[model samples]
Target: MVDRNSPIPIYYQLKLHFKQQMKSGLLQPGDRLPTEMKLCRQLGISRAPVRQALTELAREGFIYRRPGQGTFVAPESAARLSQRTTIRILTYYDVLWMASLEQAVHHWNFSHPEQEVDLTVTMCPRSEFHQVLRRAVAKGEAPDMVPLDYVWITNYARAGYIVPLDTLDALWTRILREDLEPVVAHHNTVDGKLYGLPTQADVTGMWYRRDWFAKEGLTPPETWDAWLALLDHFSSPGMRQRWGHRYAGAFPIGTAAGEATLNLLLPFVWVAGGELLDEKGNLALDTPALRRALRFLQQITLERRAALPPQMASYRWWNICRLLGRGITPMTLGGTYEWPRIREESEWTDEADAVAHLGFVPVPRPSLDAPPVSSLGGTSWVILQQSPAREVCLEILKLVVLPENLAAFCGDGLQISAYRSLNRRLATTPEHPWLAKVIPLLSLARSRPLLSDYPQVSRFLQKMLEQVLWVGAPLEETVRQTAQALALLLEY
Candidate 1:
């Protein structure tokens, strides 16, 4: 029976009620369940919660619905519920991870028939993923596992929405931690506990046309002056005509690009020796280094006209990659993850063909002597606290991170592995020669600040960029005001 006053959501309670019925043989396989209206009346609840419960039950394979008919227990529901455990997962539109999870489940079931496990994967759109995930948690419909952005670990952990991986299996967690790259491991840890398992690692940098550079007797830029000179060289009418290029470079510059803008541009702060937070973990945005970085961006986009201002402000996050892939732009501020998309958009035959024409580099520093920097970003699998299948999910995760499985996932996705050993192994292989180039960048990569309010902070940063770069607001004032605004936000 559904308990209205219980802490658990009404819909989830109803879901459990139905599961109990199935387990007790009261609702046998192929038995028709009551209609939504009937369930609502019996439970003395609203229709919405009743529908939500039924929908989730159907999605999880506990029931099947026929159009214009009714819902019935799945034919094999009895066997499945009695024998195998089903692990529910929610992820964004990452087909590689989905395929890897599916393969991992299949291997697990095949190898351990007695403890067979099934998977129910739900995919959400990238744009709406954050909101959808929060809604699911609020509704007590959180899945057993989810692929979360690395930066979001702190938020979820602090909210108690996610379980610490170590709490489930400390020894396995420690081994997994030791196997991961130092930075990757660090990003998934909070309060000295492992909170998630990162599946891949990615670094943000610039993508340029290697073939064009070679043809013109030019080299990849390493400093601000050299970068500016290269942009100027490409912006010329003759150079533009010679290369058939529409723009010298492209990047996201406004809120429309969302977090991509932050990932691509934040490295400039590090290049200028700025940090977003002080040692005390307070807002530290109004620094000279940050000002220098912002001014540099303003000069390139608005003053010198190196890129299309209107387009930069409005571009979707992937637009720069599309431009570079289509040969419309010679250079683009992008990430390692964009390689597959670039290859697809350019219609290249394979990784080798794409590599022969494209070159990737860390965003340029202020001086040639300064070290290059990039923003580290990746997705990690987190088990939800609300899940009843944590142990089963953990076992599946173990299989997912097995060396062969992780390597296959990374290679197929053209992603860098979070494991140091896997990366070292993959780097030397002919099948993933590109790893040899990108794996080194992980050393210079830095993660976004891990704050519970990071999403809000990112939005503020995006608005700051738009105000100065697009709206022509005074740079100093905008920086100062933005910092103050962030301070106020954090205060509450």
Candidate 2:
């Protein structure tokens, strides 16, 4: 029915009409929505309102469109249409490890069939996440819950897009406080409010081929000097020819912006004792430690005689892992997140083959006396401010964070769970011997600054690295300029 005389906007009116139909069960799952042309004719209105209504509905999870096919009622929406309470979740998907997350949701659904839930999984690039989420929020279509990178929580919280869980339930809060790893607990608490729940944790390190090391009669390097020597040894021209590989190591210092490159580099800065910001909350890039780290990187990367190839300047972080797996590079700076993929793709298919050939270690120290450092990695689950079902969302989050479920999810993804008890349990299991090596490294793990401007700051660091490695910019000048940019970004 066209409300020609009503003061409400045509699109709003049309949206209400369709929503009422859906809520009343007039529309069922798999039911096709009318085409824009048909909707226009049926409502006696122009295509503009019809299109707007459809777009909003789609964003709200009322419907979905399949390529080369028509729009259909979303299964989750159809099931939830008549329910008194419904909670919606938005999550990211990557072919590598998203299956565990889905499995968790399935477990929840199976255990709680009376509850209605809708999940929207997006596989968009990480760079586009904020944009997509912001648009949905602006359109009044934000989901009840979402999984966010720990670094993004501060920004979202500051902007009022998400709510602090501290005031929700004292018992639940205490459970999280007791179970979450200290590093993750600290990261999720922004300005004294707990805004997100840590789901997993990761520690960055190096993956090398054990067989190659043994063939060369060498052991994994334990110090920075030894590491450099090892890189040079494997990259020798004779060794390259003999091994039939072109690159000795893969270190992603690509000019293209990505979180992976930043993650791979941050630990180096920490080990050198370089901080992105100082006690005054100002940029602190131009330091002796940073200079030392960059020079070493230049020696191993940008120099013509270096072990790593020049083309590494264009490779993404995962590309380095793939190269290592394919044996194109004997070693690569990577983390446990890529372990499953490497195991699946490498020639080592059995445990004996794997232990004899493939291996990993904490990023080497500057010297035997210096301590090793690993950058803390992984994400947290956030409840948005716009969520109508806050209580329900909290319950769902609790289920997701249960120690057993968290362990399963993190173990499957080859990640470190943020639960200290779960990690301690994994450390005891002989089946995953790598966990013993990795769990100890978590003590040395450092998190990136949870500032609202960190994304910009990280990009600035990447740009500075690219300038030194690719553009041949003067190290001191480039770092000074980058520090200035970081200060300006943080100022506003």
Candidate 3:
């Protein structure tokens, strides 16, 4: 809607209209907008104002035009910046986590009103996150700060999208070394340069029905065989009848093209003693251990039929939490970030109630004596190199990550803090008893190889996993082809 005779330029009015639509939720992330010709026809305007408006919009990061595809809404983080001192922070966390971060931002603004720095936190859906980020980066509209998965820190640092924190000052470096957990701190540093700061730390684990296990007089599985046996037992017709569920277990095998598929499945590769890279940085993905891991997945999804539908392979990461909360599956592999969500979704407000019902354990190993492995889960905050207010962003980040502020932020969201001191406090506190059960397992958590081309490698592995589990591709051929593709990527 535009006023034909208003003093405002037509292009400026059009831009404001689109912005209002996005802010009001009339348009959403990944939603395609009207084509330029369509808009021209609808508004009875020439192509000049339409092109001018879209060009400005693209530069400000409001909309992105794919080559063959039409313009789509960009990530909320890259929304056109108003004429104020604002620093945008983007995350893929749930609404609750955003609320917690919003509180910290508000407090910081209140304390420094004279030189107020507006910190806006936006939640971007994980399924579209990669596309959103790519568009934002291409337009030079990356958010001031973003929460990146640990595995992505290396890739982003290598690409020069993020600046090293060591360039800040001595005080920031000291805080990073002394306050953060060693594993988290180490992962944030790339080639001996610190590039990010941790917001929370998590370990991947499988959630089970505690009461159901107790009723059946069964303990959590400790080995691969026992794990499958548990799923088979529960998948039987009688067991399904008793539990009133359609499936025995589930996994996020979705094609969302991000960390979800990789994070949950990495433990299996580690448990079978497979590594993604060799001593010479060559692709080691075609090893027997990895084959074993893939075979087991094939068994569950194809042969035993103990897992969710084949369509589950294309589901989003959060779909598992929703399915689990609804009792669609008795078990699913997930991380600590989902516990609070499970509670809220299942309508279990009392922490004790959620604890009594939902149970999480480290992923099982290949043999009785072999220790289980968990992927190093959660994200870290990195400042984009394109941001103009780097110093102000750092100061604001310091306030947000303060010991007390961090404790409140992560604690409220049911996440383990990255700060060593806060983790130690939660390890002993009754308020965070669930975290206590997870503390010992952190010692066994494994991190993926930090490679500049890891993103492409991850995509290849994901497609390989899908081809076998969904399309019933031959195991050896698929593995070999994926390995070759990864080799080429690594070489580049």
Candidate 4:
């Protein structure tokens, strides 16, 4: 009964068909099922999906294969399914969220002794997580759960690789929807259904040396003009001699920086009143605001010579933080998530010392009357459709998102909680000074465009920025061509 035209893969459909048969008692324990060749012929499909279906069935404890005989139903398969389930998970940067998962697993096993579940976790490199995950899904070997970037949620949801939470448990989904922050909720929902649960939140902004700013009788820039004025002052021979600084400021502006380039620069477009998509979800990249933003960046880096052009293109995302921490630059663009690393690199004695020396601000606007802007960035937990233990995975996620667990994770990571209630608590908590400082700015944060093709779109935007600021290409034509390329990409 596999639908060839359905978004779901044929192998998955075949697996579901056999699973239904077993559940309905049509295929009982010790019953031999059809061979792979026979099933392919009967289902009018190729042998690859049939073989994959059988492989998954065996792995999920639903069926058993003999060396020379044939495949048969697993003995007491239905009765044993819940008792001996092992959920597999894939994650990266196994830090705060991974610890929470471990705790959730322990709690689940302790509370539900009759239905204890084991866990198998695989850690991947952060830079290659998305590509590796996509390959796994394509091969029908996806893990049961993954901590996915919020922007990529739509891609997985639309491709039928992940199931909608509402379809599995509507009540739990409704409760989660009501509990998440509005922006976080917006990023996790695709086509009116929630698909992922965010674990933490972060905002992109600039980090400046508070001590140095005060010493120079200067404040954080409030407008683009003021920002350029500060850069001009800092880049002068007198200021460099006085402060022993090497650069006026720094931020990533090259393709090598990857998504970090967008994290740091997209706010400029927002502050200029530019959007990547219109209200109706059409491409809106070719705008005066974008051109203005790009021109400003080009003027500072290429024309004015405040930030070195060749160095800017070669800098990694974390290099800016390192420059700021080492007192090499007066100011640098970064995210709140980098606080711990920055603090460590600076060798600040403690949180109080770090706060006394450092100051964080949203990206400055184009004019005095304009509002500052920031981009929201975070990771969320999502269940893959290939998971045979969706219910069990949901149970673990529920425990992971408990108020105390979320607080602990965000507190240790120095990140904002996606839950508004916890954020309110963090705002008043004195021990978490960094969170208290940045929580108020959450209102100014906006998520990047949530599209299945966002990875490609982001690449185009990165290339466009590099083309102008680093490669010295004409700004208008570059932006226009990139916009056209993006439109064509989305068209098909």
Best by lDDT: 1
The better-scoring model by lDDT among 1 and 4 is 1
- Candidate RMSDs in order: 11.5, 11.9, 12.1, 15.3
* lDDT score, candidate 1, position 33: 88
Q: What count of clashes does model 2 give?
A: 0
Better of 1 and 2 by TM-score: 1
Among residues 3 or more apart in sequence or in different chains, the pairs in candidate 3 whose N, CA or C atoms overlap within 3 Å are none
The residue pairs that clash in candidate 2, if any, are none
Order the candidates by lDDT, highest first.
1, 4, 3, 2
What TM-score would each prediction reach against the true structure? Answer: 0.80, 0.78, 0.80, 0.77
Q: Estimate every model's Cα lDDT from 0 to 1.
A: 0.81, 0.72, 0.74, 0.80
The positional error of residue 332 in candidate 3, measured at the CA in angstroms, is 0.3
What clash count goes with each model?
0, 0, 0, 0
- Cα miss at 487, model 1 (Å)? 1.0
Worst 10 residues of 3 by lDDT: 93-102
| Structure candidate 4, residue pairs in collision | none
Error of 1 at 420 (Å): 1.1
Question: lDDT of model 2 at residue 161?
Answer: 94
